[model samples]
Target chain A: MRLAAVLLFLATISAICHTDGYIEQVTQQIHLLRPRSGAAGYRLKDVDCLSWRLAVETNNVRNWKLVPEECEQYVGHYMLGKQYRKDCEIVAHSAIEYAKSLTLVGDGKDIWIFDIDETTLSNLPYYARSDVQFGALPYNDTKFNEWVAEGAAPPVPGSLRLYQTLLPLGFKIVFLTGTAERFKDIRISNLKAAGYYTWEQLILKGEADQGTSALVYKSKKRTELVDSGYRILGNLGDQWSDILGDNSGNRTFKVPDPMYYIS
Target chain B: MRLAAVLLFLATISAICHTDGYIEQVTQQIHLLRPRSGAAGYRLKDVDCLSWRLAVETNNVRNWKLVPEECEQYVGHYMLGKQYRKDCEIVAHSAIEYAKSLTLVGDGKDIWIFDIDETTLSNLPYYARSDVQFGALPYNDTKFNEWVAEGAAPPVPGSLRLYQTLLPLGFKIVFLTGTAERFKDIRISNLKAAGYYTWEQLILKGEADQGTSALVYKSKKRTELVDSGYRILGNLGDQWSDILGDNSGNRTFKVPDPMYYIS
Candidate 1:
């Protein structure tokens, strides 16, 4: 009975934790690693949402307009859930190990590319809003950009940790994003406020490249980067589009994101 | 008390089900869809194994020789668990949807590719053995080949369904496996026995490709298929090497396999 009581308390806290993960994340600067003190009650029976996420992560399902309507709560719970953080942590762990494995050239041409939105910062706070419905609701660029303009997005703990770790490892960082050039100021502030201090380049989508598909625009930018003599040693993103195109670095790591599909 | 008793009974059966999943799989010819008749208890605290699997599934971790020793039970439970089937089901769902959307050519040139082990045919019965340790043990070729020679593998229900679905949808089926040509006859018997009745081509690795890596060997084979005028519309595999590199199909579906990895 005591065990059940404790589990109930933990389950209650666990439920509340993921729902408000970003609040604690932004205000508290916590990593969202663990929700409570004990093993909480959760089941793998929510296989539908789990399946949707797996398909999204592996790029088997693309251009999904909205998450399955039935999976709104599941997606919310997952986005705010412990597993998402763990998935991101494993990716960070892999990136750190890979970054450490290389012998850096003294010339500082070795670079690591990071996709900005879900890779460097989490938009969970915005995505969890009543209007957003964890992306089951229609996407409004205006609403999203307003959230971006507010500069309240928190650093994705795993990615921020990777960013910090890469600084001392002799890999120059590049922040690549699909966010347009107009929001560059706000994005920079958001990044800095969220702990990203510097980068060799912050390439946002400029007007000149407007209307280009993410795959093509990103591919061209990467090609230009490679032609400029910077060797991309590692690339990290939440989208397959970030890591799939040419000049895709030596190795690519995908941080989990199921809130929305960009391509 | 009645609910608790029912739960306990279900739990017992669930435990027995996954441990002996392959036995039932091979003997019953039933899709391992649901494990039993109730809501079985499982906690998601096995985060490490879950994370390792996500990393593997997303191709973040590659070239792993064996499952992490700590994750043996977790991997076993996952591979034999309901989620594995559900994951594969989602992939198949996506493949079916994608295949339906495409306009197939009437020339018999439109084809779908399938990989053998852990893709079209499941090696779970062998991988779940005491010697295999659910892939925690170092791979033994002689032992694995012995299992393959028995010609007793089951079809991955999702892939088999996709194979069947594709055939009537006007898509030719092409089996492209890394298994050596010497085992071709056994593989054919295994495929036929497992419900894959006919295929446009069954390509096994020949002596000329013995020294090649899985990626290079598979790329060369796919190039040959393409050069011969086949347009690969869909390709399904359990390994990243199966769907990446030159001449990768128009779309690829990765079925869940955490037991072993091939680069």
Candidate 2:
């Protein structure tokens, strides 16, 4: 009976926690992460609100700067949760179902665009290591570049499934990555090693593409694809830039990546 | 050249719309549905903010009251959008993936709880009619009862898919609805007609259950399920009350319903 009483008390507290008004309050706090000034007298600098913003920003949603070092561990744990993986899998599965509904032209002009890093390949193992601090550590291009060159990064399971599923369905696949052009040969090798083989094209950023924003550069490539008569049926990426902008395919599926942000 | 200029202009607009801070502001406005007063000097009664809240409240998130009659058409159109369907599908697909990961205890005690109404059977057809009005129209029990008695509400495709998928995986299914017990016969018939055949139980609110808040009634029932030795692996529902409170199971998947919110 004592146990039952305790259980009842806990349940009551849990019920109160989830009230619609409470959730709304939390949601409002999440919104404080927006660039706008604080709401009248409410200070947006509240720690809890900032933490909530960090989580939201790291997820599929865009905006806010990189999470503070103090918040990195929390974000890292969140990313590693089963829930996060489930979210990604859900998006991928829905994308597949949508792909199945399309009436493919089968002219080999039906192409699916994929962003490589964090989309096709995951650097989770690298991030998981103690030496390489999770999201809190500023991005070191030299170290990251070395990791990419090693070609050991594993395929994100959801994306791997998507890649495998799209191939037999008569749609051409293409890799459009933001990695510098110099890593093209290594990237191809890494992709093949990671179970991705033979894309229609592997477009990388060249010297001429330097200084251009990711949104502009990727959109330009997609526009070129459209100009050349390729019907981009699907576009998959982690960042908003990868899927937004002009010439975005018929559908865009965003896979969650909270580890880092790219402009 | 002309086409390129047009695309550039559109792209610029898109980029501006997605900036981190701008999205946070939009997200904050959506949460103003809470009954609380506005933050500091920010008036919660602002018409534009209210309008925006009405639109979001009717889509994926939950908990705002019946929208104003003036916002009905806007919500109606939103419900009819392809994007809305896609978002629901994404959530359902993710739930299914999470379910697949659980190892059933095989005691016939492993159960999955599903909320009726928007979670399983969609009331869209009835709501879509011009005479019915969107969420803004006050809920008429007599008319809704008539619709239930007709046993024609279509099954939400995602929930139906989940229902079919779970049965084969050895999990017992149950319907735990807030619907009055008087409609049990019609509800059962409707479930069968809509392709959800067997379940461990169909629990409904009885006459004695009246005057109780939905959160309390639902939580008490779930507590009973737990006491009976059934391990609830997952609970899926459209309303927060369906998935919250006591014995919320190991996981809860919220299916979006921007229509009427039940307290």
Candidate 3:
């Protein structure tokens, strides 16, 4: 919504390609998500960030190492802007509608799988930092982990709403993530702080799963959940990897995340 | 690109919805695809059509009866505009990249499955007609069938490119459509008319599949192919039903189609 609006108003959008100097400027202007005062709204075309995002959401674009350098500003605005939240709300709306439609067993074993990052929590604070370039730069494991250590990421928009609704419907929430086990305590506090207080399990990638792809790692974890007699009634994630593998729930809902791809 | 722009230029877009009178107006303006002369471009938001479309593409929204009435123009602009073509191009790019990455056996049994409507053919001409409302109104099977009987649908943008590239890469092509078998001859003439001169199999829904869900019907057809010794290397479609069923290839690509939803 308003996010792409600022982009439309900006005349300098065509110069958005990444360069050291440009990246430096981009990092300094995390505030650029806002439009300049009195700028006329007019969308200019480049690589069509709208199309790029749709491609990413549909998994048509895979393993993209970085956002197209030219779409950095577009992605930044989108992630930080109104459209992202509205998109999340729509997803939550759909998920809730579908969840309500099911005649569930209502047993304790009926579980809902939720991916932690970008799905349950927003790392926007860290991603918008001067060094991070909103994921336009290559990922730094150390830097991201430091952000994880802070345990302060907010809940993703609309996610807590979905969670609150699902809980009353008797879904045992399973928090699944690719984050390493060492960060477990911090993640618990972060989830609580972000309004996600309890869950049946908070699964993290352990030593044995360290080298596996998110798809493989998640699939194995979901298999184990099913083995323990939990029926995966619904699964929701921002990454394709979260929803593509074995036992991907009775239905899967994909939350929008154009900032980074995980698979 | 230009499609949404014209929408931005018009001041009447917010009035779009499913009233009988509104439907009449909508139908009369099949040519509403054209933007009127000399107006300021300003995207006014209602129900956040962009978010709605994203939800549909990600399969978060499912079994929808018709396009949301309010989003008719937004969907129309997107489908007929540069965005739709660009989205298709990106899907083709991803599919081709994945196709080339494979070490194919060079045998004709290595096959690619394609869904017909909105994947292989553009029903835009019919869908855009005065009576159809670009899918804003409820679907009319008889009208749609009459349109199909003409065998005049065009190739979805980038489909031909993907097909041509795959043919050279030693992959057998399968044109799988939910269109009934009665239209087989006409569809063949239609596909060839649309530049798809060849395919290993042109599968149309037969009596056996009359009441089957697309997921079941397609899964059965694809299983038959695999049983016949074909390797489904890739599958592409505009519907989740086309790609979500059993034995759905090693990889899948979803082409964007906002006009209709097939469960």
Clashes of each: 0, 4, 2
Model 3 docking category: medium
Query: How big is the positional error of residue A235 in model 3, measured in Å on the Cα after superposition?
Result: 1.0
Instruction: Score candidate 1 by DockQ.
Output: 0.60
- DockQ for every model comes to 0.60, 0.02, 0.66
Report the Cα lDDT for residue B219, model 3: 96
Q: lDDT tens digits, residues A162-214, model 3?
A: 99999999889999998888888999999999999889999988878776677
Worst 10 residues of 1 chain B by lDDT: B26-35
Task: For model 2, give the interface RMSD.
Answer: 15.0
Ranking by lDDT: 3, 1, 2
What lDDT tens digits, residue by residue, belong to model 1 across residues B6-37?
54764574332122311111111111111122
lDDT at B64, model 1:
59
User: How would you encode candidate 2's per-residue C-alpha lDDT over A6-98 as one tens digit per residue?
Assistant: 547645643211111111121111001122221111112223422243223222123334453335556667567664565556556656766
Query: What global local distance difference test value does model 1 have?
Result: 0.77
- Cα-based RMSD of the predictions, in order? 12.0, 23.9, 10.2
Q: Considering only N, C-alpha and C atoms within 3 Å, which residue pairs clash in candidate 2?
A: A35-B21, A63-B20, B58-B258, B59-B258
The fnat scores of all predictions, in order, read 0.79, 0.00, 0.94
Residue A125, model 2: Cα distance from true site in angstroms = 1.4
Best model per TM-score: 3
